[model samples]
Target: MAEHKTNAMRLLDKAGIRYRVWNYDPGDGNIHGTAVAAKIGKPPETVFKTLVAHQGASLFVYVIPVGSELDLKQAAKAAGAKKIEMLPVKDLLKHTGYIRGGCSPVGMKKLYPTYIDDSAMKLETILVSAGKIGLQVELEPASLAAQVSAKYAPLAKRGAGEAASN
Candidate 1:
C-alpha cells in the first residue's frame, strides 16, 4: 500500500495520536457523510461530519454524527453566540483549507473553536474525514477532541422525517 499524507494525518502523526485510516473510491462525486460511512463500513452514528458555522465575525466548527442535524439553537448556545448559521459552501475552502467532503476538524487554515456532539463520548471511537475525500481516520473520541481543543456538547438531533442512523 502507498502512503498518503494529508494535513490532518500529519498533525496526528506529529502529536503522536493513534489513528487508523480507511479509504474508499469516491465514485462520481457523491461525498455525503452518510455515504462515506457506508463505504467505510461504519455505522453513521459513529462517523462524524465536520461543519463550519459563523456567528457575527467568528467562525466555529461543529462535529456531529453523519445522520444527524446540527441543532442551530443548541449550537448557538454551545458556541456562546446569539445565533449561528452554516458557513456558505462557497467559502469553505478559503476558510478551512478543505472542500466540503474533505474538511477535518483536526487541520485547517486556522484553529477555530471546535465542538463535538456529546453523544460521541459514549462511543469508544469515532471516524472523521482525513482532510481529503476518499479517506477517513478513526480514533478515540477523546483523543480527537483533545487534538482539536474541542468541547463536547449536545449539538445534534435527528433530522425531521429522517430515520436515525444508529
Candidate 2:
C-alpha cells in the first residue's frame, strides 16, 4: 500500500531530507507514546512526542521521548521564560493547527521556538509524529533539529513511578 503524505512529510521532502515513515494500527484506540513505541517496535526513548507550552503570548514547542514527561521547570529555563504551562488540548488545534496525538513540531501554523530533549541527540535517529495519528517519521536527530530550528536541551523527566530511560 502507498503511504499517505502529511504536511510534515511534504516539508521534509521539499528540503531534500531523507526520512522513513512508520505506520501502525490506531484501531485499538490507544495512541499513547509507549503504545506507539510498542507498535512501531522501537524503544520508548527513540520515539518522541511533540508538546506545546505557552508563557503569556509566547508559545514554545518541545519534542521529548514519549515515556518521559516534560520537566516544566527545565522547560521554562530552556526557553528563558519565567513560567511555562502546557497548552490546553482544547486550544491545541487553534494554536498549532494539530489535534492531540497528531501534532508534529514541523509544519505548524507558525514557527514557534522549538526545543528537543538532549536525549534525542544521543540517538542517531528518533521517531516523531508525522503530522498525523498512527504515523511517524524517523530521521536523523540533527536533521530534525535543523529542519525546525530547534535547540537540544534537558527538557524531559521520567514521570513519578516511571522507569528511567537514561
Residue ranges of candidate 2 with Cα displaced over 4 Å: 28-30, 158-166
Q: Worst ten-residue run, lDDT, model 1?
A: 157-166
| Tens-digit lDDT track of model 1 for 100-162 | 888999999999999999889999999999998899999999999999999998898756675
lDDT of each: 0.91, 0.91
As a TM-score, model 1 comes out at 0.93
Q: Residue-wise lDDT of candidate 2 within 16-96, one digit each (tens)? A: 989999998887655799999999899998999999999988999999999888999999999999999999999999989
| C-alpha TM-score for every candidate | 0.93, 0.93
Scored against the true structure, residue 15 in model 1 reaches a CA lDDT of 96
